[model samples]
Target: MSDILFSLPVEQQITPCLTLCKKDELPVIVINHPKAKGAISLQGAHVLSWQPEGEKPVLWLSPESNFKQGVAIRGGIPICWPWFGKAGDPMHGFARNQLWQLIAHDENDECVWLTFSLEDNEQTRILWPHSFSLIARIKMGETCEIELESHGDYSFTSALHTYLNIGDIDQISVSGLGPNYLDKVVGGEHTTADKKLTFSGLIDRIYTQPESFSVIADPANQRSIEIHHKNASDAVAWNPGAEVAKGMADMPDDGYKTMVCVETAYVTNARTVTNDKPQFLSATIRCHKNEQK
Candidate 1:
């Protein structure tokens, strides 16, 4: 890998080619390099875009997503931590609403390594009283690798809420999920999927004891995506479908047709972590434009 340099925004002044910018007033770090390109918002340390060389976007972003402060964008790899879903106030927790610090970054011809950290504050303590540190380390290249670590004493459900884009939801199938899942669409009814998951209705299921790698086949786009993860036993597959997409103020009526959520998570009675034990999760996503089989 060749050594590369990028210029950062005058205010951020981090490095070369890695610039700091704003989108509709939200602070973001824009990475424009030879091997990778993407944008990461400091607010939540959330990845908004990651389009590697010679491939389509692996992440799905809602077109109508609001980039305002305190407003979580409707897509991308949302770090659903401390608690998942509506278990706590402010919807998916305040982590997405708060800003994080860029702790480290290194670049080469192959990829760029970035680490961001978010620690407990008065505001977070007010919501869920606990002192903790959340670190998100991302490596961008042909394959986007993300690792999340929680350093504290706590037991909470979490997920790397990832949204995968598809040419057509009806023509896609997610393989490698657990055989059994708790169907959220049918009020947490336990069920089993016969084969690869195909979207037809409002599908929201938490697949427990899942495999390490899942394949998302997008026949309409003539490509498939590989989602591999570690340090987790669960996966969440969500598609709002037609009927339920009607009431979402953040999502358009037809938005669900373009994207699906296949998150690597730990939602089912996540193991407790104390000062003696630190919790962590890692995942890597690779996109390939192979002809659909």
Candidate 2:
């Protein structure tokens, strides 16, 4: 592979080494940072996140397991390798903490592929001990797509969490989780078939076998975000509520009232991929304008 370098448009450099793409009449901003990876932006228009740079990306979506945000899928949107969140091992994995280099750009198609490697590192070898190449490509067009491809010698756990912007959490309800659900926070064994799925209090649960799911109508923006996932076996939902949000240094107390994550993934010793055959998992969230008819 050739060494590739990406140049940022002057207008965006003041914020970060970012690039913008406008295609299919949609706009996207790609932030090229060593510690942060993946697409970070708002739909319909670009919006900045509350999280500071040089830290793990506030936005996450993955093909592994939904552990973090963008939905609540578990372990978050982190690539947990060697050991997921163990002592000496980085919080999630090196993927989110390492700076990704821009490998290629497709202006006509409106796409950018960013790549990161762990093949030549002593620190990573000590931790992961695997030779691999991870590429996260953000494509803007009719559908905003984020593709994570891994090529190497190990299997890992991952998540694609999405913090969806909705009119009001109180006005929303999720559908399609079949009969019972498993709660991972308490223990992986407890089950619930009693309560209808509603968001009001502190919630952190991994659900499975849903008929289908969606966010309720948003009167604030007259738009709702619809999510879809593939190659995933589970889902997660979360909100910090009041007390938890206050304790969190990363989240604002009021932030919980505006965003809710509905993640798509497989979590906690669910699956693994290796050198012989690499596997993939992904999720997509699309914003639909709830026009007045």
Q: Against the true structure, whose lDDT is highest?
A: 1
**What would the per-residue lDDT of candidate 1 be over residues 1-293, giving only the tens digit for each residue?**
00111222434646775778767667788887787777788888888878787656667777677888888888888888888888888777788888999999999889889999999999899999989998999888888888988888878888889888789998999999978898876776475756699999899899986889999998777789989978987999999998888888788899899899999888877657788788988789988887535
Deviation in Å, model 2, residue 280 alpha carbon: 0.8
Candidate 1, residue 86: Cα displacement in angstroms equals 1.3
TM-score for every candidate vs. truth? Answer: 0.93, 0.66
lDDT of each: 0.83, 0.48
List the candidate 1 regions with Cα displacement exceeding 4 Å.
1-13, 291-293
List clashing residue pairs in candidate 1: 6-15, 6-16, 6-17, 7-16, 7-17
lDDT of 2 by residue, 1-293 (tens): 00011222323432344565322222335544442333332221112221222222233222232212122122123333333233235654555544344545443333333333333266567666777766555543333445556667655665555566555667766654445456644656445564445677687776666444444345565665555666666666776677776776556666567667776655554456566766665655455566688
The segments of candidate 2 whose C-alpha lies over 4 angstroms from its true place after superposition are 1-88, 109-120, 188-196, 210-217
Worst 10 residues of 2 by lDDT: 1-10
